[model samples]
Target: MIPSWQRSSQGVPRAEDEIASLKTQLSSISDLQSTRIGEAVAAARDEMAHGLAGRVSMVAELLTEIGGKPENSMLNLAEIQANLEFIGLLRGPEPPDLPTEIEALCERRRLIYDARDVFGDLFDRVREVLEIPEVSVTVVGTVVHDDEVDDETDEEL
Candidate 1:
């Protein structure tokens, strides 16, 4: 027959072990969520960049055709107008293929924000469960503006 304090002491170790396991699982899930968010943002930016590049190429071609055929000024004007319309379509309020990959990225970012908030709460809960004091995490970094500074110095000179 164990004393009451002994029984309580035995339960404390089991509780601590469970808390540690939960903390590990939460950390892993948070890391995975962060990685997915980063991937989604990268994919969206790439898609937008590619679309912009294609639009620029079309505009350049229109300009070249107009420059090459000065006599057909009316035709050139019509071509330019059509090209402009296309550009406007690309940037219009109602996109042809509405709710695109970039839109998905926006949704993913919101989910990431929510997940981060939950992660923070779980971190706090873990600390409480393990009887650990709260701690603040800090990150420090430096930004080097060598190119900008050099350009400014050259302009001054």
Candidate 2:
């Protein structure tokens, strides 16, 4: 027979403590996974950006070639190129909203984490001051097994 400290009133391991410990471990693992996934995404984006190099030059050369055609000589290549460059300049390299949106989301996440810490501290203080006895809980679950196995042909028929 196991000691009372190691087991709950129902003679099973204390489930709440085990569950809380598991949650903390899983949270750490998930945070690491999230960071790895984000890094992978950023790497993929960088690879894609590198692969797309020279595409703009290709477009510019094609446009210049088209303008050089005798029948299209009247078409102003300089003006067209200037317009394209102007459009590119107007975009101003990098979206203005993305950084601000990221900042706002980060701020919200910080607030949420701060609130969680505050609540956890409050709960700890209340429990400590009241000298409450922690309740021991045990989780029990069941699994069902099917003994009869049928072939795929039998199911089809």
Candidate 3:
């Protein structure tokens, strides 16, 4: 009888079945990680969009007040009022604590990425022990600039 590690006359080891099983498990893990990361990313983006919408509305209101007396009398206050009208259409019915929500989402996304990376490294090590080819891992997501958002808003005004 051939050793379990040795190939049979057909040129495949009994371990092939176990290896296939591991592959399936690894694939499932990867799919789950991808899904989770995708969700975190989407949540972060949605939070930012909501936050920015609210901010734009606030900025428009501030501008409406300030635009009344431009240092340059030649500057058209009517244009500012028109812009305010445009922005009014985008305001949320109920204001959210957008800065806090955005910060929380960014933190959540960061933690998820760190966890996924650690798991992926361990998964690859297991595949190596099994003598299976290493699966390539790719992390796809945007880097949340929690600080830059505020800075940009300040600069825009």
Candidate 4:
């Protein structure tokens, strides 16, 4: 038999303490992993931004124009670019919104990360720290558990 301190009331290993510690570690690691996923998506967006570099230059030139009234010259170029982008949807550099090719590229990048494989890696990391040795929890004599209740039995002995 294991030591008394290692035994719980139900004669099982004292898992509550281990569970609490594991919960803390898991929450922190999960948050960090979540941030990594967000970073990956941001990287994908940045890669897609390269497709809009030319449009960015056009907008810059339009904004910097000083020869004519703001609306007339600026909007003329803007409207022209809009029409060009719409017509050249499947031909030239991409606009900001419709990321057809970019979306495929992002999916390709993400495809390498299979769900089963990613989760397997995560679980492997977690298990590396899971110390499930011969746990022995000593049983307490009292059965009092912390539950929200009112024992208003006035007829009690």
- Best TM-score goes to which candidate? 1
lDDT of 2: 0.60
TM-score of 2: 0.32
Q: After TM-score superposition, what is the CA distance of residue 17 in candidate 2 from its true location, in Å?
A: 2.7
Measured with C-alpha atoms, the lDDT of residue 4 in candidate 3 is 52
In angstroms, what RMSD does candidate 3 have relative to the true structure?
25.3
Q: Per-residue lDDT for 68-101 in model 1, tens only?
A: 4343444346457656755777888876554564
Q: Residues 34-119, candidate 2: write the lDDT tens digits.
A: 99999999999998776555444554554454343323222244346545754665598764465665575466556656655655
10 residues in a row with least lDDT, candidate 2: 66-75
- Which of candidates 1 and 3 reaches a greater TM-score? 1
- Give per-model TM-scores: 0.38, 0.32, 0.37, 0.29
Candidate 1 has an lDDT of 0.63
Query: Predicted candidate 1: what Cα RMSD to the true structure?
Result: 26.1
Q: What local lDDT score does residue 1 receive in model 2, on the 0 to 100 scale?
A: 63
In candidate 3, how many Å is residue 108 off? 55
- lDDT of every predicted structure (CA atoms): 0.63, 0.60, 0.62, 0.58
- Better structure of 2 and 3 per lDDT: 3
lDDT of 3 by residue, 83-147 (tens): 56446544857665657655755665566566556555654554444446743344435555576
Task: Show the colliding residue pairs in model 3.
Answer: none
Find the number of clashing residue pairs for candidate 4: 6
Residue 119 lDDT (model 4): 47
Highest lDDT: which candidate?
1
